[model samples]
Target: MEILESKEQKLFARNLICVGIDKCENGDFCGRIWEPYDDQPFKFTGINEMVIHMDDLYDEWNYPQRALNERSFLRTHEMARTNIIRDDGFVEKIDRLQKMRGEIGTFIVQVKFRQHATWQGVVVWAEENKRGNFRSAMELVHLIDHAINKGLLIK
Candidate 1:
């Protein structure tokens, strides 16, 4: 329920990445979001950046029946396959985000919820004024790098 500035959202949009999970026949496997810990702000991370297990967090909300409809699902999957730079950029940014987090404070990351019936797409959310700043984009990238290196994204 947090309203982020268009600038921040744009930065986030540039930073966000989505990946496709083929195993999900009905729905799609989007990317992930991480916060330092519970009660902390949420940040978006791309699909390639983390190896997520669909079973771990996959649920009714992420894979709703409406998202499974033939047309919408196909479009979502197609988008995932075609978007390459967005995917690669996500990986690169993650590396930078994590590194910055280490220098600033202790934190945990989690998946941000987009909406029901959006296939694998995820929306970034944060506590009001609690979200990271433009200067922290590098740190956000670093956090992603660490998650990838640690295999935290792997399911």
Candidate 2:
């Protein structure tokens, strides 16, 4: 995986979405992926579709952890890539290959996939300098749910 410098300009120019793989120090394949949204200048709504490879499934039960270090579980499987959607108007595609490599000896996991697998997570960011006074992550989650049901995340 390549660490693309997430600059302010680049983030603003193109819709920025990130995918990461989590694993133990050992060389064990734990199928897991993460997608995050940081729409600074624009107010993003949600994601489109998250697609992942199917061959990476190891019995479909034993898999990597999908939740991030923050303990936010998307309620998806580990072997199968998951997708999350927001309500605003932004979409991010996630996959195993796009996972970020661990830093120098920092005790991290590696992301690998025999085939191309992808998943989409929808996210909504604040509008450009528009403070709606929206508080609480639950509120944001509700908004995302609404967007998903409305089919607004689709391209």
RMSD each, Å = 16.1, 18.5
Query: Model 2, range 82-123, lDDT digits (tens) per residue?
Result: 332323343233232123331210111122211212212222
TM-score of each: 0.19, 0.19
Give model 1's clash tally: 29
Error of 1 at 17 (Å): 11
lDDT of 1 by residue, 18-114 (tens): 2211221122222333321212322324333333322122332232223243243344342222222233445445544443322212222323332
Model 1, which residues run further than 4 Å from truth? 1-87, 102-104, 115-155
The 10-residue segment of model 1 with minimum total lDDT is 20-29
- lDDT against true structure, model 2: 0.24
Best by TM-score: 1
